[model samples]
Target: MRPVFRLLSDELIERIISQARDILCDLGMEIHNDGVLSMLSDHGASVDSEKMHVYFTADIIDKALETAPDSVKLFDVMGRQTHDLTDHNVYFTPGSAAINILDPLSGEIRKPLTADYVEYAKLVSRLDNIASQSTAFIPSDVHEKISDSYRLFLSLLYCEKPVVTGAFTIDAFNVMKDLQLAVRGSADALKEKPLTIFSCCPTAPLKWSDVTSQNLVDCAKHFIPVEYISMPLSGFMAPVTLVGSLVQHTAETLSGVVLSQLTQPGTPIIYGGSPAAFDIRFETTPMGAVETQMMDCAYNEIGKYLNLPTQAYIALSDAKKLDAQAGLETSMGATLAALAGINNISGPGMLDFESCQSLEKLVVDNEICGMTLRLARGIEPKEDFPAIPIFEELLREKHLLIANHTRKHLRDEHYFPGRVIDRANSSRWEEEGSLTIGDRAKSEIARLQGEYEPSGLSGDILAEMTRLMRAEAARFGMARLPHEDL
Candidate 1:
């Protein structure tokens, strides 16, 4: 059997699901969106329009679960399969919609511009461990109305990989779909092999605003895959116990699934979250805590049990500085999530409790991702073990690298060495300037930035994307899109 781990037993999982159902059926959720309230009410769900509390029946959720697809194939711009979101595999990408970029040289956090988004896209496309790219940071220089579209447009222009992104407004989301159509040549063509995954999240205490619900609704209507990120802060927004937090997460995600499928049966939806343990001392959401990783595996267990694709915020650290703590936390969090078989793991390159993004940290996290995947693969023993014969064969060679046994299996059996990880002796290390991991990481992203070449968009598609941006800008009383190239 393939390797996997879990925290909830079959009975325990059933109970959690039962409690989630009770939470929805009993307490219900506050729906701020009139359209979403109507959509649920028109279906079998009960809606209280005056109080805006909508209660979903277990039957509606069960139906949604039955109709949701078990696997989704996402493709790169070149039309190659990038990731298949299934229980057996995992994919890593950076966190989306970050507003600040940490400068590698100065160690200063600053607002990102359009050029910065292009650079971030290029960096992600070159990282082998990142299966896809996100609109990593929002550019502050652009008009508030068009910033979302601008970031995605740059990602589409530069990232050769599949994209993980979202929309802030319904209008922006429509433009995103238009951009997808422009890239794939037609609407039907875009659906054939999707090049992007859209995400939307509920406000943790069982609240759904119009934008969040509408994003899922739009995704369902367009046949686009959507993921619900249900973030609950334990001890603050949710009950302090881990089980209670899991129940809250389950309820919010299941609600999204039901609403999406109710809008369009057979719409693809992912059950995922970045549930946090509210740090009482600091009043912060520590993304790197042991409880956070534990929660990662736990929610994944529930999602996989339901045969739904899973995602979580792992492969990250809350360290304000990129130091040993960052490496230690990142290594542990990412490995646990990978072993748990999450499909799409985000939060790489995030720091300061995910309020900041660092390209240098991204370089380091890329290496962390590689090693974690290697660990996840586990050992492959093709034949029965004979300890005596193995020992005798090893005794024949003073150095194993010269042995045929070593020459044949070494590359596949061992992780390819990481450049940032220090494995050299003191003398050799001192000869190399004794650079720290962060120092080496800074150099790495700098080198990549120097040599990276972004894949270009087709002329026709590029023109269409420009036109969409310009028209969106016109809504804000601007004549043309900012940073437009003719």
Candidate 2:
């Protein structure tokens, strides 16, 4: 119900402001992108091209927060239900940008296909634990025709849940628009409530890319929520000190929020980051490393101080295989984020420094998400004391709480595990075929797939979507589209 950890107190927030001012004045972010620099100059923020630094003060950040909505309604594409981001419970979403899916049995990495992505999406949508879904897995290779927008399209087609997505290129915006049309069946549907788009802008200490900046502006105009993901690699792109990283992340995220607000006042935004560190010896960005977890915890504090909806990259690992280290890191990072009460936690099923995804892991992570959600609900105190006289009488004879009244309460209080999780003893498990967790998970996936009924799309609406997608493809000068079946 309440956040278990606070990263920034009143004194700490002031300290972050002081440090941000120092970074801008002394060591500034490198703005290699010219367009970003020009925008900064156009705004009141100071930009020195020579120094390649953009200095944004706390006042600018305040104005940005003021323009941002405290909460946003994330719409379900299937017109099922909307999730209120203002709720106290932390929501879990699937991972993002995974190029490979690690084979748990073989330990070999394989490129994921569109079918694989669709299956995964359906699986996630069916799970009660996942509050939202992301086109988390991208096909490693697709026909050139649909290569550009394949992931977004697949996500729109397969998922019925609220989607957490980002724009990879300028054209991706159009892809999103087409998908919106498909979901709503008409342009007027968008006017009521458009799909929430979370566009990531590079860190404050780093210039926003041209494509990313343009996408942010477009999303604001469409009234889509833009989630500014400030990924500052401390000890590499940023200072190694925690305070230093926090300051840089704050300034960068605030700047993004400001730009979105300036483009469209009252636009919703999430203060988010994927800040991590480069493993010096390994020469890699460790997604589930302890340092990454620490950064996530600290930055979450910073976001709370600003009083904005927060999103963080957690529930990932650096391990190439689903080994002990992978399990440990992913569990630790995910549990910490959940306990801290982050609004949105990403990076489930992610591995190999966030470059790979595993379907098996995704299912396993959903169980973790389910456990965390239960934990976040905290322990409920009994209102009526549960028939004190009867309970005391039962306790007097025996310590067993399995009496009729107690049994009823126990059933109500317990959180049941799904098919994949084994609570049975060895004897019972052996009788049931002695399946390992992975085997059981695969079976569960198959069962769900068999039972899943595709969301109803009228023939007319389907035709319209096909027409628009083809028209867009033609506009892009492509004769064929990738994943045409979608």
Candidate 3:
């Protein structure tokens, strides 16, 4: 049997779920999408058009739960599967939508540019631990209307990993679909081998915006997976208590699933969240706080209880710099997310309360993810009565390092950190210039950026993707989209 890493009790799981049902059935939700309202009404929900209240009966939520798939398989740009949604695989993608890029050497936070997209995606592709890519930085240089689609375009261009990104509007989402088709060759092929998971966010306090709702429906209609990033801050946007906050999250997520399933049964929907607490002193939503971790673990437990594929917005930091504070907070949150068995963990490279992104931080977080993933791999004994083999080896006066058993099992039993992490003694460190992890990470980043090459997408496909991207930009009133390395 797998180890009991779950946080919520059997009874409490039922209670929280029950509270969510109450919230959905009694309180209903404020939905801003009329088409979604009509869809819900057609599926046995009561829709109040003027009040914008969409109520789900217990029966409807239960049916929607049944319609949601238990797992979602994500594929990379090359049509290779990248994640196992059923094995509790904790895949880390960089944090989504940071406006600024923190330069590792100069320590300057600069407005993101198109080149930042190329460099970031290439670095993430070369890193073994970064299993997927996200729209981590939106280039401030792009036209505002096509910014979201352009990020997806650049991510597809530079990264081979499966994309974890979103669209801001239905029109932008349509453009995103066209871009994927330009690469995949057809809509049917894109649906059958979805290389991206379209994320949609529901507003806090049980509200789903019109665009977010439409995005979910569009993803379902196209058979692409959808992830709901429910963000609720306690004592501000949500209730002060953890249970209260969880209840709101439950309702919000459940509401999304209901709409998605009504749009298309058997649609893949992920139970993902970034819920946190409101800090009074700073008046900020400190996503790396202890309470935020608790919220992450709690909602993850609820997701497990429902047996849905789970994700959480942890593996993050609130530190402005890549300092001790950043390491401490990011490590703790990553470990918690792994323990909770979150499948797709997003937040690497996040800093300054999710307002900034850094490439060095991405390398540092990779080591942390390796350690957390090692811990999540619960202990498995190799042999029965293994102490006898150990005793015999000791009796022979043979060092364990030279033993066959040691040679065979060391890789499984221990996690050897990457080159970025230092594990040597003081003397050895002095010989190696006493490089800090940051210094080593800088070296690694440079090596990756130098060695990286964009996968040679077919010339025909490349031209088509470019055409779709430029046409959308022109539609958005741009005479021309800014040219990059492409």
Number of the top TM-score candidate: 3
Ten consecutive residues with minimal summed lDDT in candidate 1?
A: 382-391
Q: List the residue pairs that clash in candidate 2.
A: none
Tell me the TM-score of each prediction against the true structure: 0.95, 0.89, 0.96
lDDT of 2 by residue, 1-486 (tens): 443865557798878866665655345455555666666667667788877567765555566677788776677776665666653447888787677787645658988777778777778767777778776766755644454466766666666677787767777687677667677866656645656556576744556666777777777777777778887777888788767777788767766776688677787778778888867787777878777777787777766766777888898788776556767787888888888777888877888877888877777777878777767667765433666867677669676466665576674556677887789998999999998777876777787777776656565665666666667667757565556665
Please identify model 3 stretches exceeding 4 Å from their true place.
1-4, 383-385, 394-397, 479-486
lDDT of 1 by residue, 139-171 (tens): 887788778877888788877898888888877
Question: lDDT of model 3 at residue 342?
Answer: 88
**Top-scoring candidate (lDDT):** 3
Number of colliding residue pairs in model 1: 0
lDDT of each: 0.83, 0.72, 0.86
- The residue-level lDDT of candidate 3 at 227 comes to 83
Model 1 TM-score (2 dp): 0.95
lDDT sort, best first: 3, 1, 2
What's the lDDT for residue 15 in model 1? 94
Candidate 1, residue 322: CA error in Å?
1.1
